[model samples]
Target: MIKNILKSALNNFQAFLVTWVVIIIVNQLFIFGACFAPYCLLAALPHTFVIAVLLNYFLNAEESNKQLNSSKIDSNSDFKYTQADNHIEDNEFEETEIPFCPKCGSKMALRTAKNGAHAGNKFWGCSKYPKCKGLLNI
Candidate 1:
């Protein structure tokens, strides 16, 4: 039913959002704030299908990494690695996230900007706050 489909889509929103981000980035190659290229329209169909397939990928990010025998994620350790039996190893390669800080290249934490021209706006701030003052708007 339509209701069931909507509910399923809502549950997989992370993948949907990621797919949209990719589409927007690709569309940017043609123009900013607009997409008039025929390739963009053609690519939309496959992107939607890929988004649905990536539902589990986006929702269980750490699990997916384990499946690939990649770096183990430690959410409790602020996504940083520590020497332990069941923790991430330093030698393992790290995946580069698109939203990492532009200044210090650290993963930006989602935070509210207190004082700025766009006060109260949600944005990404470098995890290394006092040490690195990198920020990005949502």
Candidate 2:
């Protein structure tokens, strides 16, 4: 527990030091517009603390997301594929055999409708999708 706390503290300190230097440089360059501005230190201190805290929060959130994903994969080590995962395999087709879009002449792609009257149904859709809006029943 102590070791983990120390490691976290060390990471935070390193992040704070980097943020402080960057904030000082930015404040000197933009706000004070001088090579060395002692007065900019006042503004940089608070800005550095805020930026460091935000950076720490976002980094921790990303680490947690990775851990969550790894844990989920580990729990499913037997490798059972869900319906969503197997959808592409179940609806396999030759890309060369699909029809061209009537509206744009672009090659049509096989797509599954998620809503409307064709919900859960497969159809040939324009590769451009929203822009072309051409579709054909499979």
Candidate 3:
């Protein structure tokens, strides 16, 4: 049962990765070809938009999977709980290491807010919140 679940998850991940790679290759081809004609731009735009949407969907799925797995750790089991606690501590420590925002050199933290009109996916908002309002894709 566990193997089947893992296999399914791996297959989905592989498919997602392949799709993004192909999207990148196609984008590069379009860019290098310098095809700015209306029809060409129109064709590429929809493909790019569709890929972006699908990528966002997969990202949400991955995040939910992580959360679900974390929640499944048996707190009543000493060994399991200890391992989970250690893992959580390690993640917190790693998060502290990312000092500056890759975008604007501001501090960042894990944040939750409405996923905008996009719905479903959560994002990392700048710690500066209303003032900076910078959002990072999770």
All models, RMSD in angstroms = 19.9, 10.0, 19.0
Give the winner by TM-score: 2 or 3: 2
Tens-digit lDDT track for model 3 on 50-119?
A: 6744664555567667766877665534663334443355446543343456566688776555557757
- Candidate with top TM-score is 2
For every model shown, the clashing-pair count is 0, 0, 0
- For model 1, residues 1-138, the per-residue Cα lDDT tens digits are 445444544656676667656655665555444554676656555655555545534555564447446433343446555576786677796664558889988888888867969789888889999899998877
What lDDT would each prediction earn against the true structure?
0.64, 0.73, 0.61
**Error in Å for residue 15 of model 1:** 50
Please, what is the TM-score per model? 0.28, 0.36, 0.26
lDDT of 2 by residue, 51-78 (tens): 6556555665566568779999999899
Ranking by lDDT: 2, 1, 3
The count of backbone overlaps in candidate 1 is 0
Q: Which stretches of candidate 3 lie over 4 Å from their true place?
A: 1-32, 68-138
Error of 3 at 65 (Å): 2.6
